[model samples]
Target: MNLCMIGTGYVGLVSGVCFSDLGNQVVCVDKDKDKINLLNKGRVPIYEPGLDEMLKRNFKFGRISFSTDINKAIESSDIIFICVGTPTSKKNNSADLTHVYRVANDIKKNIKKFKIIVTKSTVPVTTGDKIEKIIAKKVNKKKFEIVSNPEFLREGEAIRDFIYPDRIVIGTQNKKVNRVLKNLYEPLVNKGAKYLNTSRRAAELIKYASNAFLATKITYINEISNLCEKIGVNVEDISIGMGLDKRIGTRFLRAGPAYGGSCFPKDTKAIAIIADQYKSNLSIIKSTIKSNENRRNLFKKRTFQIMKNKIKNKTITFLGVTFKANTDDMRESMCLKMIPVFLKKGAKLRYYDPSGKKKEINKKVKFCKNIQEACLKTDLIIIHTEWNEFKSLDFKNLVKKNNFKIYDMRNIYSSAKMKQKKINYFSVGR
Candidate 1:
């Protein structure tokens, strides 16, 4: 299959590379010249595990290519996937569909023959109907079929998720469109991946629903963690006990500062907005959003309380800054919220992340060369992201050198071990 993927962000780039690896010729289009240039130079613009290698291999094999010409990409492909970003609009917290609509207009202008236009970007329910109307204004109705096929790729594990998705949802009423999409994903279907066909609106809602539910789970656990702290109960034990039940399998049960990333924060807000627009109330989702926000703010209060409210001259080091480990995405990161609070209290801040952007971070904060340097002489260490490197740190050596306090925000360390070493340790809900 020959495919054109628009908007080479995380979803577009990973999907293009993986689709090409699956024996399809894929051309990824992006308006950003720098990103296109970087890809042309055999370099990735983002940090995702195993993505660079797969991209290089597919590019080398002539199965994939990068382009800035959207028209050319559309002209050469039988299927076009709109994998653009639908960020939360600042105006009303609804999804900003300017990019998606603009792409639809572009497709209306460039699409010449029968084409399967797939909405691989996470979009609002009934967005496919809007796209169809937009395209129908300029082109014949027979020229295209708008299929809502939202992606479910996680950040750090996108490649694996793309190659081996648990299930694939194709939203279209057209029989031909459904068959075409099924064929496009036939490789995965042969490998035990479930291919579900549903209405376009259901498919769009599936993406939002899945993300909102996961966000609720994270917030639920964080709330439980807070209660555990007050009652002197271990949240980990509660998580394990609950997860043992077949009905409640554990995934995002770990207590952390908050849930922050591309999907949860925006999708949850978007869903809530959508519910309000239809005169429906999603009270649980609204509470989840509020709970997550409160959890993020609580980190600052918890830090100050741990320091006995004397943070004016304290030096703190954050182990990781990215929302979660193995990806360099800082969008909606809890650290973004925590940094200002610490700085406002006159605390000196240092951080070490394997792939976080130094320039994008606050100028007041210092970026260290490594974990040791970041922790050296620091008053406290806050483990923000659960990176594997942070899990096996030499706690005894670190504490012996600086006698610094350890606040395990991700709860990656054992409290008993830190206690045995006489290290001052604090962790979430445990």
Candidate 2:
């Protein structure tokens, strides 16, 4: 199939590459001329594993291309996928659909024949109906079909997830359209990926609800970690015990810093706003949001206690700064909130992430080129993101200072081992 993917952000770029690798011709369109130029050179703007190689391979085969000309791409393709960002609105938590609607208006002008317009972007419910209404105002209803096919790609492991997703959801009641979409995804469907056909609205809601539930699980485990700390218990043992139940399989149950990523924080708030607009009370989700926020502050208090309120002039090193490792995204990273506060309290900070330096941190904070440089002579080592390199480290050798403390935020290291070495180690729960 010839496909046009609009807005070459994470979703657009990754999906376009994956589709092309599956033997489909794909053109990824974006307003950013620089990004399109980069993609045309077989280089990606985002840092996703295996994406650059896959993109370069497909581009070499003439299967994938990038363009700033939206109308031309739209005219040439049989299927148009809208993969623009629908960021949370400033005034309210509802999604700001300006980009999505703008793409719809652009599509209306360029549709020379029947096209299946699928929204691969995360959108609110009824957004497909709204897009259909917009396009119908300018073009005939039979000319195009609006679809809500939300993406389930996680940041770090997007490539693997796309190739082997747990499920593939297509939202459109039209039987003919459903058949076409099923054919489009037949490769994955053959690989045992469940294909579900549902109403467009249900498909849109599924993405948001799925994210909110995962956020709830993270918050649930984090709160449990707090209680475990008070009563002297291991949160991992609890997570293991609870996960043995068929009802709860462990995925997001790791007790760590508050859930912060492109999806969770924004989606949780948006879902609450959506529920309220429908005159429904989603008190549990509301509490989950509140609890996630408080989790950050709780970590702040723990830090102060660990330091015995002697933050002034203490040299602290953060192992990783990105929300989670294996990707370079810093959109709601817990360190974004904590780093500045530590600086204000007179703690000199340096951080080294596997993803490199972050712009979100204060200018005063030094960016170390490597972990060894960041840890040299530092008073405290806070294991923030669980990057692979940080998992097994000779911390005593890295710090090279007596009485240095290690705070394992992700619980990646064993507390018993730290104790055996006579290192002052702190971790979540136990």
| Model 1: lDDT of residue 336 | 90
Residue 154's C-alpha lDDT in candidate 1? 96
Clash-forming residue pairs, model 2: none
Model 2 stretches astray by more than 4 angstroms: none
Write the residue-wise lDDT of candidate 2 on 319-397 in tens digits: 9998898889998999999998999999999999888788888889999999999999999999999889998899889
TM-score of each: 0.98, 0.98
Worst 10 residues of 1 by lDDT: 395-404
| TM-score, structure 1 vs. true | 0.98
**Where is model 1 more than 4 Å wrong at Cα?**
399-402
lDDT of 2 at 122: 89
